[model samples]
Each structure stands twice: as C-alpha cells, then as structure tokens.
Target: MMSGLRRGPLASRFSPSRQAAMKQSVKLIVGNWKMNGLSAALAQAESIREAVGAAGQGHRVVLCPPATLIDRMRTALAGSGVAVGGQDCHEKPVGAFTGSVSAEMLADAGATVVILGHSERRAAFGETDAGVAAKVEAAIAAGLEPIVCVGETLEQREAGDAIAVVSAQVEASLPTGLSERDFAVAYEPVWAIGTGLTPTLEQIAEVHAAIRAAMVKRLGESARTAPILYGGSVKPENAADILATPEVGGALVGGASLKAEDFMPIVKAAA
Candidate 1:
C-alpha cells in the first residue's frame, strides 16, 4: 500500500440509476483473487479498507475472491468502499451443474460484479465467445454487473491479428442485451498476466481504441462512454502510467492485488 493513499468514506448506496451513470467516473480498480485465499487473507482486505477508507468519488474498488470467500469478504468489507465480486459463474441460475456456481448464487453471496471470458477461462477451460455471451446475459439476469473481458495471445499479436482477434471477441462475447445494462470490459493481454511484461503505452492505447470502436458499433454512440480497463501486470510501479493512457479508465489487477500495500498505490494512482 502506498502510505500516502487515503481511504474513502463508507460504501455508498448503489442504485440502478447510479449504476447506469457510473460511466461518468474514471478509476475502477478490481482485484481478481483467482483460486487463492484462505480466511486469513481477510487481513489484507482490512488493510485495504483502512488505506482507501475515504477514497475519492472518481475512484472505485472491488475485490473478486474465490467463491468460498465472497460472502465472508463481503461481510468483512461491509462498510468499506471496496466491493466484493466473483471470478466466474455458470450461465444458468439453477441447474444440476454440480460444482459450478451461477451468477444468481454469486449475487446472493454478495457479488455485485462477475468476470467472464477471462483469458484463463478461454484458454484453460475452452470458454468460447458464445459461452461468454451467455454468462454476460446471466450476470444481468441475476442483477450483477459483468466485467466482460477480451484480449489477445502473444501468438495472435505476433501474427498481426491482435486488433482483429479482440474485435471479433468483443463482437461475439457481448450481446445486444447489454445495451440496456451497466457493465465494464477488461483488456487483459494474455502474455502479460503474471509475466512481468506489458504492452507499450501506444500498444495499450491501440487496443483500447479498437475496443471502444467495436463497442460503439455494438451499442451505438453511447458506447464511447464505456470503461475499457487494462488488465495483466498492473502493479503500483506502472499503474500510474497505464491508467494515464487515453482509454484506460481503470484496471483489472491480478497478483499485485493480493496485498493492500501493493494494491493501494495502484488505487491511489487512479485517484
């Protein structure tokens, strides 16, 4: 945490209207816990709570821990401005999917947002664009905003298909129904996740601009206001520069988010 970072006031009320109007803000730092965390990890959360206790109106903070920790973290961060979220959820609200958790259950457990179409899910679990679209619909149906993600692999970038790949994914992964809802998109270049590498500022701007153009085509003129966040390798060291880019409204942070000391500076940078 950046010792100079200041916490915001207690969590603010979230209404559907307010949700729709969130496009007016800038920073929206979200932490994806992936499959890590035990109950003890709540301490880091508490530290984060203290650090950003009265964060500015332009900044928003969210933490997406594994399923088991969602409810617990929500309760812990009750008054803190930090919001709790889920990493993934099945498209259906109710089913015999066994271990699969649906967006409804996540919402019930206090997840205000759900991340779908992550590169890990797409590559490791074979989550196709169609499937991601379904989950986005599910998230809305369950009353949870979805942080839909899209990105390109190193090979695709090397092959000169980075923009095309991301454009196609945005076209396929986002459905027309999203035009009626509030959501955010993340561009997490696959090669950068935990790899300690990041695209140049120009490279980041290019992809973000491409994504904005794609959404504009999908949602019409209003899409220009959508928050296209940069993910992968987002840490305190470079968060300021990355967030300063033209279309980088915020970030979808990975490993650096595990601790408040590291995450706060990034959060502060956004502020």
Candidate 2:
C-alpha cells in the first residue's frame, strides 16, 4: 500500500500545469548515495518508498546506491514505483579491471539507471568524456538508462562559459543515437553540489533549456522528451521552485539525499 499525504499548495497549484508538463515532464529525483551505505542504508529505501507513496505520483524517484547495495535496494524498492540505479559502471563488460563493475553486471544486479561522468569521477578519477561515452554506450547496451552528468566549475560560470563548457561535455559524453528511454542528462554545476549555493531560477532555466536545445539538435524529437535534471545545492526548500521552473524536470540530490527526513520534502516538491 502507498503512503498518503495531504497535497500542500505547492502540490495543488501545479496540478493542471503539472499535468501538462507530465506529457513532457521527465522530472527525476535521483539519490546518489555515493560511497556511503551498507546493509543499514537499505532502510532509507523504505523511507524513500514511503515518501514517494505519500507524495502520490508527480515525479520519478530513483535511488543509486553503491554497487554493494544495488541488489538489496532493488529488492527493497520492488513494486514500490521507485527506481533503483547504480552510482557508476565500467565501460567494459568483461576485463582485467579488478575493482570495476561492468554495466552488464549492474543490469544483472537489477539496476535500471546508472550515473555517468559525475564531476567527482571526472576530477578525482580523471575520467574523460570519451571514457564516459564508452560507459554510456555499455549502459545502453545492457538495457540501463544512463543519467549522464555534465557540469562546469565556478570559474567557468564566472567566465561566462558555463553553457559552452556544458554543451561540449553533453555533446561529447553522449553516445550517438540516444533515445529518451536510453538516457537522461543532469546539469549539476560542479561548484554547486553540497555547497549550499543554487543558481537563480533563471540561471537554472537557461542552462536546462540549453541542454534541451542541444538534445533536440542531436537526438531530434526524442531530445525534447528527454528529462534534463538539475543538480547542485538542491534542497527540500528549493526543490519546489527549481522543479517548477521551465525545462527543469527534476533534481540530482547530493548531500541532502543522505537522510530521509531531508530528502523526502524534496521528493514531495518534485511531485
């Protein structure tokens, strides 16, 4: 049974508009649990399930736990209407990559989505756009939707090159022939994640719209239908306003996603 909560003004006001957006609404709230989580973390999946159940359908909710916990989270979310995803996956299906998990392995573990080219992976692990593209291809081949992350640093934003930088990243990171079902794009503004700084609603809209336009140019009609989510300093307080913005489908929550109490309202906001 789904949990139920009264619809607040935020939820009610968007009904008609949201219904309209729903047709093009690719809003997704993905929780990147990152390197945190063990068996105990699985409990949060229930909390997330309850939250989504209470919110009652307005957004798509996904949980990308560590590989170790993907199967557990998958089982926990079964029939719960929430999607389970993987934090990352290797480009190769089989190899001498000792510590890496392949995209096929993730799909076998029951993951339906995978996050690729996250800023951390790019910066810390030195992953290139070409590498990300390979992983994106592998993920699609394995029947998983890759939420390819693209972003620019504060320096780039300050230099007025945010769009140009992100545009290049999107174009290079995405594999050719991407369809709405095969992937989603996340614009996480590298400097914003967990920094408590959100782009103004206008800035958010501009970047998202730019991403959509890029998609349309590359993927045609499917690009318009592809959900482009916003990331970076996204919290429950701001989730509603951001998600309500034009071209803003959903969010890629970072630090806030660690707690059910903190994350649930953001889910509600999306709904």
Candidate 3:
C-alpha cells in the first residue's frame, strides 16, 4: 500500500449496503473515438450494442465519439445497453464562446458522460488542473458522469517522477463535486498513447495504486469505489492482461475502439 493509505476506522466503516455496492461495482469499458468518427461510424456503434447485449451484464460499456456523433450514436444505441458520451465540455453551462459545447448541451444531446482533462487537452490546449476541476463541477451539475484523466510523459517517468506527478494531478484535477457523483479516473501515460507500447503491469499497478490513494485522501471513503481506468494503446490483444492488473477498474480504449470486432474483445476481457 502507498503511504497514507493504511485503513483507519473511517475507511473501514462502510455500511452493509455500501459494502455490497462496492463489491458489485461493475467494470467500466470506454472507447474514445477522439478526433475520429463520422456518421458512417454509427454502424460500428450498432454492432457493438448488439454484441454487448448478447454478452450480458457484469460490466458497463460507454462510447465517446467526437461531438458530431453523440446524438446519432445515442439514438442508434438506444435500449442496446451501450451509452454515448462527449469528448469534452466547457466548464460553463452557456456562453458566447461560439465553438465550445457545454455540459448542459451535452446532456441535452443525449450524452450521459463526458471525458475531461485528457492529456491531449492538457498538452495541446493548455488545460490546467484547476480548469479540469471546474469542468468536473459543471458535468456534475448537468447530470453527466465525468471521467477525469491524468498522466505523465516519458521524460517524467524516466526522471522517476511519474507517481508524484500523476498523484498531484489526481489531487488537483478532481473536484469535490465528484465525491457523490458517478465518475472515473483514467491513467494514460503520454508516451504510450497510440505508440503501440504499454508499461509493465508493475508500473501500471504502481500508478493506479497511487491514484486510488490520492482519490481516497481527497474524497474520503466514497472515492474508494470509483473505477480507475487505464488507457493508451489498449487493444484486444493486450486488454486482458492490462485489465487484470490490481486497481485497474476498467479500460479507456482509443483507435482500436473504432471497430466493434476490435473493441468487443476488450469489453469481453473486462466482463
């Protein structure tokens, strides 16, 4: 266990109902389409819905396509046991920002979840931890589950700062509003996303354990049950091993998610 994570009465005092709920918490498998996905992709979404319906329960599956496909995918996947989500949302519910989508708008468009603070957003658009916290609050207010992301680059890992850096990001980026709401945290090492490389299971376990400790310290016992998802170059071939890692509550898949044949195997692994 990481420092400060030793169980105290507070951590061990969950009620019978809460204990059962925690034990039954389903694995969450999310597919992030990112800047890919067009209307034509709805077919893939339908196929996944069909597969998951046959696969039965034991896990939760969500698909986050570009904003353009949120509504269409939601409609197509209706009653199929799959959920639709947005890639990002503005912290404010409404504004003249012209090009930004708000959490309320995402909810209105049929998105039940929103991904915030992805490394791409942080590195490319200069998003700060405070900014992600603000967005988390907005998503909660709008009734959308937020999946807050945090990670370190190769240089930071090489410098032996991966755990510390990611721990700090988890502390700063997650808002208190998330304490009672459904949400997830995704750890996607900047160096591994789309690189066809992955950290050893030991490394993944280390970071995920650190993240869980950070979450519990910040949010108390309620944080203990929230899923901590792994992301990067996740695919069917490696999904089982990664998902089997201790503290890994699920996966956040990228390119491989674009096709049902590729994505379903990962979901099956979680199931």
TM-scores, in order shown? 0.91, 0.90, 0.92
lDDT of 2 by residue, 181-240 (tens): 446799999898878888899999899888877777766654555678898988888888
Candidate lDDT values, in order:
0.86, 0.83, 0.88
Candidate 2 regions exceeding 4 Å error are 1-23
Q: Cα deviation of 115 in candidate 3 (Å)? A: 0.4
Prediction-by-prediction clash tally: 11, 1, 0
Better of 1 and 3 by TM-score: 3
In model 3, the clashing pairs are none
lDDT of 1 by residue, 1-271 (tens): 1111221231124443353345535578899989889999999988888888755556889999999999999998887778899999999889889899999899999888888999999999999999999999999889888899999999999999999999999989998988845678899999999899999999999999999889979876546556789998999999999998988889999999999989989999988
Q: What value of lDDT does candidate 3 attain over all alpha carbons?
A: 0.88
Candidate that beats the other on lDDT, 1 or 3, i.e. the better one: 3
List runs of model 3 lying over 4 Å from the truth: 1-25
Q: In model 3, what is the error at residue 198, expressed in angstroms?
A: 0.3
Indicate the TM-score of model 3: 0.92
Residue 173 miss distance in model 1 (angstroms): 0.3
State in Å the error of residue 191, model 1: 0.8
On the 0 to 100 scale, the lDDT of residue 246 in model 2 is: 88
